[model samples]
Target: MTFRKLMIAGAAVALLAVGATAAMAQTSAQKALIDAAKSQGTVGEQADGYVGVRTNADAELRAAVDATNNGRRAVYARSATEAGTTTEIAAARMFETQLLARVSSGQWYRNAAGQWVQR
Candidate 1:
């Protein structure tokens, strides 16, 4: 494969490696809270709150992708590369940049600019 393709593959592997180490290791407090929510039928209620969070994150990612496409179209749209390299690469780069930069100590919320923030 090409160098860029190899780099992308390596990056993907690295991301998965790091994510594997990510503390899905829940604290007892957090696990207990989730359990209580599930038992109390509060999952639905909490989901109601999370619906906005989910929707907003999806919207932000979509917008970032769309914006990246528009920008790439004006620039590398004619470049002789992979079919989606211009747009998808840009979006993925943006997202990876965001993910690396935003995550911090025990953080759990998206900030106003769509970046992850500690809550």
Candidate 2:
């Protein structure tokens, strides 16, 4: 094989390897959150009012803040009360904007396909 052809093949292989590594390393942090959420005792016994199971949501929020400019994002949810055909509800998104801001700046970016891809 020609030297030029060999060099091109080597470059392609290296690029593929780097891409694979990035994919593999793509956000083990989310798993960390899920594991924490599933664990017991983190929320404490007989806890009430948005209590979490194993992970501290506050700590995670703070961590997101710290991950500024690193592509971190926050997930949010709220409790709702639906009464009539038009649901009457109260919404609480305490960490919504902050989390999104963290995500906008952190290491979270979508791929060319518009799917979530790690940076």
User: Which of the numbered candidates is closest to the native, going by highest TM-score?
Assistant: 1
lDDT of 1 by residue, 1-119 (tens): 99876655554444344433332333445435433433333221111012012222334434443443343333322221333354445334434543335333443434335543342
lDDT of each: 0.37, 0.29
How good is model 2 by TM-score? 0.20
**Positional deviation of residue 60's Cα in model 1 after best superposition, in angstroms:** 20
Model 2 lDDT tens row, 5-118 = 454334333333333443344367743643343232232111111122333456674343234212211111111111111111111121221222323322332322334333
Cα RMSD, model 2: 20.0
lDDT of 1: 0.37
C-alpha positional error of residue 92 in candidate 2 after TM-score superposition, expressed in Å:
47
